[model samples]
Target chain A: MSRNIRILGTGKYLPSKIVTSEELDRKLGLKEGWAAKKSGVKIRHVVDGEVNSDMAVKAIEQALKNANMTKEDLHCIISTSASFDQPLPCQASLIKEKMVFKNHPIPAFDIDSTCLGFVVGLDTISYLVEAERYKNVVIVSSEISSLAINPNQHESYTLFGDGACAVIISKSSKEETSSIKTSLIETYPEGVHMTEVRGGGSILHSRHYSEKNKTEYLFDMDGRAIFRLSSRLINGFMERLFKDSGLTIQDIDMVIPHQASAMAMKLMRKKLDVPEEKFMSIIENHGNVISASIPMALHEAIVQNRIKRGDKVLLLGTSAGLSLGGLVFEY
Target chain B: MSRNIRILGTGKYLPSKIVTSEELDRKLGLKEGWAAKKSGVKIRHVVDGEVNSDMAVKAIEQALKNANMTKEDLHCIISTSASFDQPLPCQASLIKEKMVFKNHPIPAFDIDSTCLGFVVGLDTISYLVEAERYKNVVIVSSEISSLAINPNQHESYTLFGDGACAVIISKSSKEETSSIKTSLIETYPEGVHMTEVRGGGSILHSRHYSEKNKTEYLFDMDGRAIFRLSSRLINGFMERLFKDSGLTIQDIDMVIPHQASAMAMKLMRKKLDVPEEKFMSIIENHGNVISASIPMALHEAIVQNRIKRGDKVLLLGTSAGLSLGGLVFEY
Candidate 1:
């Protein structure tokens, strides 16, 4: 029998600070409705003094509660994030420590793939669980993109929020109720340079900083190019995913794309010919939470009764690495 | 029948610039033999203008040649590293562009767990291959640790080197003479703070350049604590590994430990009761290459005829994440 990795629980945490597009426009000297109409974003949540680990912990706590699981039940914890609290020990270690799971000594670490990180991590967990190497896995996607955004940089500052989401994947042999039925990950390296953070990291250290040289270490992006690429890749990936799984678009009850720009999501919907009701998006309120976008949206969708048990949900994401991935799950 | 993931090819790339411990001492005000006697590091490579992607491309090129495979043969490429060029798009995507493979798009991304990255990456690939999700996989572990080192910080400066290693894994069911037998990964979150880079990440980004900042965002380590933890974990893991594999120490031909420090290796060897001749240390020439250390040493061992075609080689590593992992492979 083929072992299936099922998501037993799902949870998300978004900071309470809400900044409206008008407020952002006034703060950054932009025209009214510019942020909303251009990106389909009305507001975004910004965390106060909340790091990636903090957000991840919140999400994980809620997820465990929902799953009725203790830390000891987890065999592995894989946390994915673009923003890290430290460069040496991964952010997951911090979460492991804070949660006081030290006694279990569960293997935990951070996985990164920009915005597609969570999907990749989820797939990795699925593989491990199916191989019987791990019984219970906790995959957390958390980001404090606001910390990397330069408030002075109008483009990125208005487009990123702070949030985290967690999914508890368990090994199961049942056919119909499995959480992750199938997953596909694909990368288009040619589009990597279109979006990125130019500074920071070992490539550009703080020691290289000079009083006169105020480098923009903040997130930098080519909005127009990303839009075009996102539309093409998102649609292409969805088509291939459905085909590979021997399913049709009509079989998918919900589509959760990365909560990046409102325009990109709309473009994807139009290109894929999927109805707006079939798509779930949280970008209007949360902006781009990077890896956390899809799962966070899933959490909201579940809460709002947009999805029900046995629903086939397509979780898709695309990011600066010019990377894209999707997972079809029966929830 | 269980499918096995076999290493079809292996390749490594060292920067052209080599710096002897004496040379590094002259530049950093350290004793000449301190690195060699204490850390078993005689010389280490340094990348000048080249970055992680450059080394990755070079290693992947050689790996392809050795495997007699083109980029199209690969279904997935997983890059593992601690020192990345940027925080977005992932280093794997950059390497994918260089290959320019014409076929179905291959999934690629980066995995980080400090020095244990390579072992964990291989384990992940093994699980994915066994699941029959991917047929051909390439795992690369590369680091530009020098980029993170503060030349003036004598402690971290003496311990790091830049290098890259790549291994191509493919699905094989043949009864091979030697192959990746088994592997185990463990993480001790309580010990994460024993060694770390205090700056450049989200935690210190705010106070990175502040005068009040005591930690310089450079690599900081509590060597004594790490020694204790390393010895305990490495010894304990090897015991369990050997028992699980039903192999004795005498059956193992060679033991390759992460090229961290000579003292740690010696202590571990003593605890494990392994003969000195059965162990190999490349730190004498490569220092601590972090994630790249084991593969680089394995490559050197293979070239030097220290390991035979069917030799049982044990690879182990531990790092700042307080993470440790091991793999048993047939040479």
Candidate 2:
């Protein structure tokens, strides 16, 4: 029989340097309150000297401590990132190196699906644990979005932040903990260009670096396009997701969603029929840390005691692939 | 009870332009036979204008045809790539977009573990299939190493190629079809930097590009270091893998190892005690295509009738994370 999977611990790390909407407005030469009015992000964390792996390691360390476990106890590591430190060895491998477990004979890899990367990682990990392939798995989302966006692009510059979140999932040692109910992940790649950085990989390269290719080398997106499409389709998406899972809006106690943008979050809250307090939104302070948004908000919610044992929680988000994903679980 | 996963069909695509050792030797101002002698690679495919997604889509189309199926039959898609077309929506998403699946609601993502990436994707697919999450899954690997590497770097320039491979895996329609037996994956991230491109991500950017960071922007590796470490540690690694699976060398009919380098391949063959014919190698003509090497060779091996039904084949490889992984299945 398959074993039950539970989220054992959650941890998040924000860079020390904080950049407020005022600072972003000044940098982008916008009027005061323009960024905040446009994106609903008041302040976001910006890294100084640290890289993606640095933030990832810190999140994992805290997650391990929260679980009352050590790095050696982890059977597998799955990292998700939109803003990677490098393309090769992967974020998980770098984290293992920094965690000082160079000889840890465990399976480690990275999953890239943009903002829904963490949800994708969670879905993958749930299956691994259910198969009894692993006992304890660490799912990490680290983003250095501040370094990825072009400072001149006011839209993305004011929306993205730098942060990391790590969550440990395992068989519940105590029977009281809740188990994962259902996870729904769907990708519509037709919207691939909706929000993207074309040069994030080999499509654009430094070898052919030129002044003309400057904007192409940074984060670019059709925010209005995504907003229009998501608003129209998300209602039906959520309806089917909940109906198929034998759940409804009333069954959910808290909704943790990817803090994509101010308008997107407000639209989702109204569509999902959740109260303001029930709808989690840490992005107003942390901004959008790509894949880390949902998990970081979930971690903060847990820390603030917004969720308790036996509560039903919902995690949902729309990602770069125009993907819409949701996970329903009891906490 | 868990279901059995089987490889239904495989396909590969090599770029039309072939760069022979002599051509590379002349380009690098080396002796005529320098590249062939140093890396044991005679010729490698070089792409002119094709992107990673283009190669991936072609490979997948061929694989689907070989499986006597079509794109709609696939329930999920997993892409393993070391060199990606872009970083945001993921290579899998890009492939989905290019494949004209404007609204195919399937789960798609990219797994990065360097050369072991395909193996990781296979492992994840196996669990998903066994759990009955999906009926048919496609794993595609596409690499544009020629474009990724620095032209001046002789070591990597001659040893890398541009290619793609796609395999369709699903539940066997026939009762007599072969099934997956066991899989083992291990990572030691201490060697993360041994094979990496420091500027491939946010660590360094084109916006801040400079002459001093030239080598960091392209693929670089300590080949000798990886060879020495892998050669020293593979014996114990294989021993544990085989012993845990309760299998001995005599049970295996073929070994499909990653074509990392001529030297690394030879060392792995000797260390594993596999016969010459049982160990497959296609790198002499194709060089290393990163994550696509194993699947591409497997496709060639099947076409050449190297193994038949009920035969045991072992897929094993060492990747950049100092990772050693293998899968044993009956084919």
Candidate 3:
């Protein structure tokens, strides 16, 4: 199906508290510059006690303000958070409640794909806008990775941040040049267990808590295995993505990748042959913000004028589901 | 902006164990028949260590068999669980992993709206199928509430079960009468705290498990408050739903509602003026299976020859987001 989407506005928010690598070194009892050397993060914004919805509402407000729109102008809110504020009512409902300004019973739900959620949300909601079911839609991705961090797992712990992002979009008209060129999302579920938080779910019931079994509750990962599996598939996957659109990697204006880890992004760019200048990264200060990574980077790209109207922006990411998602869209 | 969908088949799976009210009466130290009197559940299937994806794959297999199709025929799988197997990779990826026969890299994701998830999944995926982004889409809602049940909260605990339901759907051709007519979903975030599981997300931090804070890890609900809030809005919501379709109560052939609770279903039928036979009920035997409730009931209605081709079937439910969703589609 052919569909077009106009980026009305993009906005992002980070937690107020900043944690530097020096602070992490002191906290984790690591050597000076050791944390930065390993994670490639100098400083990261981490939430102290703020709820996910608090950061989320701020981002949504900025997006609406940027577009000169209001909550009343939205038809539905799609919350695409990897981690959540609460699990029961879904993230979107909590977000809507926090967004009290001019808030009505606008329909809300959640699309969860871990880190690659932003790309999927944009691709999924475009069909609704194109079908005319919604005139104006807001896609918000909020992640509180700081709370999810396992201080014991310093390897993955230092490489995380907390943030939220919102993108306001509408259907493009025939005269508009903005449109999604092509997209692909594929999951290799065999690698599902490589990186995950085992608690807070039915399989690893939270009620079955004990001091001996604490590791299951924290973030667990076989980082090398995940990278090995992802690397095997990405080359062919990227080829098919551009091939389907009758375009090449060099044809893209800019690349916005999931700020997964400093090393992963570097490896991905090298493997895909994307130039260092062409790849967008906020990992130096932001670390990996989970599902908010792509949109947060996109928002930064937009404000910096690195990507203007009619720019072909490539969004690519590998998520917890061992999912590889990529999209080339006109911004 | 028109879309049509044809249901090729529907299937359901129950756990291996059946927990009768008589058994619950003994287990909970209640008087004989007291459990059934309060919960209106004679028997309910509750999972006994079987994983969510295990039951989900079984349901999917049945659905595919009913349509004489294979997993390879599907372009995507949408897992719409109210509760999840895990909190990390999303429910759909885990399900895809379980359905290994003929499995390939089919795009998978989750649409979460608590108990109304099945309705939301069907409604949301329709836009994609109609746009020809996917030729065949399977929506599976697998929930295991038994493990999350708090033994102390008998009121909400007894009114739950575990099961999975899958529906195989495709785009309807021009001559087919099977089409989604009108759908409405609205969330009133004011009632967000009425029903929820406090643990398992970034907010309730699963790692903070302690003896003094055990209740936070289990399913918690303010049943009366939720009912009161839902009642205040449903009458108007139902009116708007049918009004949008230019139809009234009598136009519906079968009313398959979310098996939330026996009392809730009874109250809903009375408020909406739906006839006794038109309303389908499985709460007596199956109880409330969360997101699987509506589709499990729909699967029963189809196999029992209640909802037939050209029949106007209504799917309705109230969810944990304190959300209300309804849809009427021609079978």
Candidate 1 residue pairs that clash = A310-A331, A321-B89, B199-B217
| lDDT of candidate 2 over A188-216, digit per residue (tens) | 87678988878746677776667888777
By summed lDDT, which 10 consecutive residues of candidate 1 chain B come out lowest? B206-215
What tier of docking accuracy does candidate 2 attain? medium
DockQ of each model vs. true complex: 0.63, 0.67, 0.77
- The sequence of per-residue lDDT tens digits that candidate 1 reaches over residues A286-330 is 888888988889888987999988788888777777877888887
- Model 1: runs farther than 4 Å from truth? A1-3, A151-153, A210-215, B1-3, B102-104, B151-155, B177-179, B210-215
Clashes of each: 3, 0, 1
Tens digits of per-residue lDDT for model 3 on B144-246? 9888788888888889989999999999988997889898899998888888887777777777767788788788988888888888998888887877577
Candidate 3 regions with alpha-carbon error over 4 angstroms: A101-103, B101-103
Predicted model with the maximum lDDT: 3
In model 1, state the lDDT of residue A6.
72
What iRMS does model 3 reach?
1.3
Q: Report residue A196 deviation for candidate 1 (angstroms).
A: 0.3
Docking quality (DockQ) of candidate 1: 0.63
What is candidate 1's CA lDDT for residue A330?
79
